[model samples]
Target: MKQKKKMTSTGFLLLITIVLFFVMYAAGMVIFADKGFAKPQMFLNLFVSNAGLLVIACGLTIVMITGGIDISVGSVTALVCMVMADLMENKGASAYVAVLAALGIGLLFGIVQGYLVTYMGIQPFIVTLAGMFFGRGLTAIISTDMIAIKNKLFLKWANYRFYMPFGSTNKKGKFIPAYIPPTVVIALIVVLLCAILLKYRKFGRKLYAIGGNKQSALMMGLDVKKTMFKAYVLNGFLAGLGGFLFCLNSCAGFVEQAKGLEMDAISSAVIGGTLLSGGVGTPIGTMFGVLIKGTISSLITAQGSLSSWWVRIVLSALLCFFIVIQSVLASAKKKK
Candidate 1:
C-alpha cells in the first residue's frame, strides 16, 4: 500500500497535465470547429509539429532525473544543424557524412560537458552555460547566414510522408489525408527506447538512487560519477538527434536556428512531471508535455486572432503552475 501511494503521488503532476491537455483540446474543438481543430489531423499534427522538441524534452527528462541539467541543448542543437548544413550545402558532403558528423558533434559536446561536471566538480549550470556560448559561437563561425539545404537525398527524406488510413473530407469532398512525418516517427522511437532505458536498465536504477541522495548512493557502492557522466552523454546524443529532426522540418539551418529551444525542452520536461529536484520522470509523460505545447500553438493558430507570443505566455503560466505543484509534493514527501 505504501509503495502504491508513493507511485501515485509521484505521478500526480503527470495526471494533472494529461487532464489539462484534454480540457484544452476539448475547448479547442468547440471554439475552432469550423477550422477543423476537431479533425483527426489536428491531433496528429501535434506529434508532427513538435517531434524534435519531444526528443529534446526526453533527453532533458533523463538529465533532470539524475539531478543534472543541460542548458546548452538549444545551442548544441543549432550547432548540429549548422554543421550538417555547412557540410552538405557548402562542402558537397554526402547526406550520410553530414548526418554522422552532426551526431558525432553532439556526442563530443556531451562527453566534454560531462567530464567537467562529474570530474572537475563544476556546477552543471555554469558548465552548461559555457557550453551554450561555445556552441552558439561555433555556429556563427560556421556561417552567420541561413543555409538552405538543397541536398537531394535530404530533400527526399524530408518530403516523404506516411499517410494515415483515416482522414477528413473537405467541403469539396476531396480527401484531406493525414500523415506522419519521419521526424515524428523518429521521436516516437526515441521515446520508446528511453522508456526502456529508464524503466528496465540497471543504469536507470542507479541514476534514481544517485538522484535521491548522492551520499547514500556512494555508500551503497554505486559508481555515481560514471552513471552521471553517462547520463549527460546520452542527453547530448538525443539533443543531436533532435537537432537533426529540427533540420528536417526546416530544411535549412542558421546560427539562430532553435534559439531558446532549450527552454522549450526544459518546460516540456517539467510540465510532463519530471521533478526539477530529480529522482523521478518518464519519457511517455514528456511526450504528452510536448503534445500539450503543440496543442496550444495549434489552438492559437486556428483562432487566427491571437499573436504567437500568446503561446509563450500560456506555456509560462502552465510551467509555473507545475513547478509550484512539484515543490509542494517534494515538501510533503520530506514530511512523510
Candidate 2:
C-alpha cells in the first residue's frame, strides 16, 4: 500500500489562527483602544467571554469528524445545567454529585443516539435532529425560567479567578491591574486534550477513516459503527461538561441557554477547514473559529451602532460560502 498520507494539520490551524487574530486585532483597535481596553476587568473578559463557546466547539468537532452531527448538543447543554440546578435545589444534592448526574444524563442521550444511528442504520441527520427536539423539550420540562445556582461549592468555584502578577502603573508609582479566571484555565485544558486526541490517537485516526469513506473503512475491517458510537458519546460528555462550566460562569441555567449554538460550533469547524462531508478537522481550527465568531460579537456590541444579530447574518453567509468551497475541493481531490 502507498504510505498512508498523514494528515498535515498545522497549516489549516495556522491559517485559522492568523485570520482570527487579525479579526480580533481589528475589533480591539476599533472598539477597545480608546482606553487601551484598559478597564480593570476587560482583559480577563477576553477569556471568559469565549470560554463556553470554545468548549462547545471542541465537542462538536469530534462528532463532525466522524461524519455525524450532533445538533442537539446545545440543547443537551441546557438540559444538563437544568439537571444540575434541580438536583442541587429540589433534591438537596451536593453540587459535585449533581454535576456527575448531569454528565450521566448526557451519556444516556449519547447512547440512545449512537445506537439508533449505528445499529438501526438511521441517518445521522435524522437521529440527531430528533435528539435536538428531545433535548429541547426535556430542558423545557425541567424549567423554563433561569434557575439560579446557590450551592456553596458552585458559588466558590464560580468566584475563583487565577490571576497572573502583572499590570499598569498607578499615579502613585505603584502597579495596578489584572487577573485571569479558573474558567480560562479549564477551557485551555479541555482544548489541549482534545487537540492531542484528534491529532495523535488511534481512535482519532479511525475517526478520520470512517468519516472519509465508510465503505472503504469497513473493507479494511475498521469497526465503523463502534467508532462513531464512541465519538457521539464523547460529544455528549463534552456537552455536559461545557454546560456545567457555562452554569458556573453564568451562575444560572435556563432552557434557552446556548440557543442556536450548534450552528456556532459547525461554523467554527468549517471556517477552520473541517470538511463538512467529514474526515478532516482539528480542535485547534475549531478553537480559532470560536475566537473569530466571538470577536464578531464583540465588535458589534462594543460599537453600540448595530444589533448583535448582524453577527448571525455574517456567519450564515460565510457558512454557505465555505460549504460550497468544501464541496468543490472534495470533488477535485477525489478526481486526483
Model 2 alpha-carbon miss at residue 15, Å: 1.3
Q: In candidate 1, which residue pairs clash?
A: none
Best by lDDT: 1
User: Candidate 2: where is the Cα deviation over 4 Å?
Assistant: 1-17, 35-44, 168-177, 334-336
Q: The CA-based lDDT of model 2 is what?
A: 0.78
Number of residue pairs clashing in candidate 2, backbone atoms closer than 3 angstroms, sequence gap of 3 or more or interchain: 0
* Candidate 2, RMSD to the unseen true structure: 3.8
Tell me how far the alpha carbon of residue 78 in candidate 2 is from the true structure, in angstroms, after superposition.
1.0
lDDT of 1 by residue, 1-336 (tens): 232364666677888889988999999999889988888988998988788889989988999998999999999989998999999999999999989988898899889999999999999999999999999999999999999999999999898999999999989999988999899899999999999999999998998988888899999999999999999999999889998998898888898888888888888999988888888899988888898899889988988889988988888998898899888777776676
TM-score winner among the candidates?
1
Model 1 alpha-carbon miss at residue 194, Å: 0.3
Q: State, as a TM-score between 0 and 1, how close model 2 is to the true structure.
A: 0.89
How far residue 283's Cα lies from its native spot in candidate 2, in Å, is 0.4
